[model samples]
Target: MHYVNAKGILSNKNGMNLYRGCTHGCIYCDSRSNVYNMDHAFEDIEIKANATELLKKALKNKKEKVMIGTGSMTDPYIPLEKKIQSVRESLELINKYGHGFTCITKSNLVLRDLDLLKEINEKAKVVIQMTLTTYDEDLCKILEPNVCTTKERVKVLKILNKHDIPTVVWLCPILPFINDTEENINGILDYCIDSNVKGIICFGMGMTLREGNREYFYSKLDKQFPGLKEKYIKTYGNNYGIASPNQKELMKIFYKRTNENKIMNNPDEIFEYLHEFPSKDKTKQTTLF
Candidate 1:
C-alpha cells in the first residue's frame, strides 16, 4: 500500500473512492483495463491520505444534503480498509452532515460500520449495495479469491435487513463458458430473495472483456481452467462485449425471479433509488393567529 495527497475526494455526483487499485484478485475486474490508465500495479493500493479531511470539508461546504456514494471503480471495503478505516471515517462525516450514503462492495468488512449506517439511515438514508457474481462458495473463491465468499456477503445483507436498512445487489460480470447457467443464476437470486434486497441490478447475462482486462482474464483462465482461454479466443476474438450464449435464457430466469420476489430489476430505476436522498423536513405545526 502507498499514500498520496489527494486534491479532492468526492466526485461531481458525490461518489467517493478512498483508494485506487485493489487487492481483491477478481479475474474479471474491468478496472484492470488500460483505459483507466493506472500508473502502479493493481495490487499496490494507492491510499488517498487526505480522504477523510477532504470529505469532511466537502460535506461541510455542500449546500444541500444528498446521497454520497462509493465503490464505483474500487471497492471501499478492500483489505486495506481494515487498517486505514478511511471508509468508516467518511461514513461518520456523511452522518454528521445529515447526508444519505450508499456503496457497492463484495466484502463483508462493511459490517464493521453498521452502527454509523443505522444512524445515517435514521437521519437521512443509508443503502448498502453488494456485488454477488457467483453463488457457489467454491466457485466464488476461484472468481474472487482475495475477498470473502458470497455466503459471507449474503450474511451481511441479512444483517442489514434485520436493521431495516435497505440493500441492493449488483449481479454482474457473468463470465461466459464459466458461470452462465440456470443453476448459478437461480442460486444467487435465491440469496437476494432471502436477504430481502430492495433491488438487483443486472445489465445482462454476460461480462465485458477489454484491452488490459482481457489479457489478464485470459491468463487467469489459462492458469485456473486450462484450455478455456482458447475457447474464449475462438468465440470472442477480441470482442468487447462477451455475451453469454445462454444470455437470453438466463435473463428470462433473472426477470422472472426478481419480478416474482418484487425486487427492482430495472437498472435505471434502481440507480434513481440509490441517488435519491430522503427529505428530512418535518411537517410544520400550525398556530392560530
Candidate 2:
C-alpha cells in the first residue's frame, strides 16, 4: 500500500473512495478495466492520506444533511482498511455531522463498525450494501477468494437486520456457464429473504469484460478452470458486456423470488432508497419551531 494526498474527498453526489485499487482478487472486477486508467498494479492499494480530513471539511460545510456513500470503485472494508482505518474515521465524521451513510462491500470486516453504523441509522440513515455473487460456499471462495464467503456475508446481513439497520444486496456478475443457474440464484435469494434485506440490486445475469479486466479474467479462468478461457473467447469475442446465455431464465427467477419476498428489485428504486436522507431531524426542528 502507498499513500497519496488527495485534493478532495467526496464526489458531487456525496460518494468517496478512500483508496484506489483493491486486493480482493475477484476475477470479474470491472475496476481492473483500462477504462478506469489506474497507474499502479490493481493489488497495490493507493491510500488517500487526507480522506478523513477532507471528509470532515466536506461534511462541516454541507448546507443540508445528505447520504454519504463509499466503496464504489473500491471496497472500503478491504483488508488494508483494518490498518489504515480511513473508512472508520470517515464514518465517525458522517455520524458526527448527522449525515446518512451507505457503502457497498464484499467483506464481513464491515461488522467492525456496527456501533457507528447503528448510531448513524438511529440519527438519520445507514444502509449496508453487500455484493453476493455465488451462493455456494466453495464457489463463493473461488469467485471472491480474498473476501468472506456467502454464508458469512449473510450473517452480517442478519446481524444488521437484528439491529434494525437496513441492508441491500448486490446480486450480480453471475458468470455465464459458471454460476448462472437456478440453484445459485435461488440460494442467494433465500439468504436475502432470510436476512430481511430491504432490496437486491441486479442489473442482469452476467458480468462485463473489458480491456484490462478481460485479459486478467481470462488468465484466471485459464488457471482455475482450464479451457474455459477459450470458451469465453469463442462465445464473447470482443464483446464488453458478457451476458449469460441463461440471462432470461436466471432473471426470471430473480424477479420472481425478490418480488415474492417483497424485496425491492428495481435498480432505480433501490438507488433512490440509498440516496434518500431521512427527514426525521427536519421534522423534529419543524416541530420545535
Candidate 3:
C-alpha cells in the first residue's frame, strides 16, 4: 500500500472514503474502476494518511451534530484499518463531537468497534450497514474474496441488533444468471429479518457496467465462470445499466417481503433516515453518550 496526504477528507454530503482503493477484493467493486482516476493499482490500496486529522478538524468546526458517513467508495473495515485505526480515530472524533455516524462495509471486523458504536448511538445515531450479494458461502468467497462471507456478516448484524444498534443491509449488484434468484433473495431476506435490520437499500435487481468496471467484471467472468463473458457482451453490449433477467419477478418478491417485514425498502426514505439530525429530542441529546 502507498500513502499520501489527501486534499480533503469529507465530501459535501458528509461522506468520507479514507482509502482510495480497497483490498476487500469484491469482484464488483465500483472503486476499482478506472474512471475514478486512481493512478495507483486497485489492490495496492492507497492510504489517505491525513484523513483522521482532517476528519477531526471537519467535525470540530461543524456547528450542527449531523451524520458522518463512510464506506461508500471503499470499505472502512478493510485489513489496513486494524493497523492504522484511522476510521476508529475518526469515529472517536464523531462520537466526541456528538455527531451521528454510519458506515457500510462487508467486513465483520466492524464488530471490533461495538463499544464506540453503542456510545455514539446512545447520544445520537449510529447505523451499521453490510452488503450481502449471495447467501451461499462458497459463492460469497468468489464474489467478495477478501471480506467475511454473508453468514458472518449476518452474524455481526445479529450481534449489533441484540445490542439495539440499528442495522441495514445493501442487497445489490445481483448478477444476471448468477446469484440473482428467488432462493438467494429469500435467504438474504431471512438473514435481514432474523437480524432485525431497520432497512434494506436495494436500487434494483441489477448491476451497472461502465467503461472501467465493465472490463474488469468481464475479465473476472471469463476467468471464474467460463463462457459468461460472451453472454454478458451479447446481452448488455456497450450499454451501462445491466438489469437482470429476473428483475421483474425478483423485485416483486423483494417489495412484498420488505413491506411485509416492515423494513424500509424505499431508498429515498432510508437516505432521509440516515441524514436527518434529531436535535429536537433533548433527552437523547442530553445523554451525550
Better by lDDT, candidate 3 or 2: 2
Pitting candidate 2 against candidate 3, the one with the higher TM-score is 2
Q: Across residues 181-270, which tens digit of lDDT does each residue of candidate 3 receive?
A: 999999999999999999999999988878777788888888899999898888989877889999999999999999999999999888
Model 2, span 77-154: residue lDDT tens: 999999999999998999999998899999999999999999999998889999998988998888789988999999
lDDT of 1 by residue, 78-156 (tens): 9889889999889888888888899999999999999999999988888999999998899899999999999999999
TM-score of each model, paired residue for residue: 0.96, 0.96, 0.95
Name the TM-score of candidate 2.
0.96
- The prediction achieving the highest lDDT against the true structure is 1
Clashes of 1: 0
Worst 10 residues of 1 by lDDT: 280-289
By lDDT, rank the candidates, best first: 1, 2, 3
Clash number for each model: 0, 0, 0
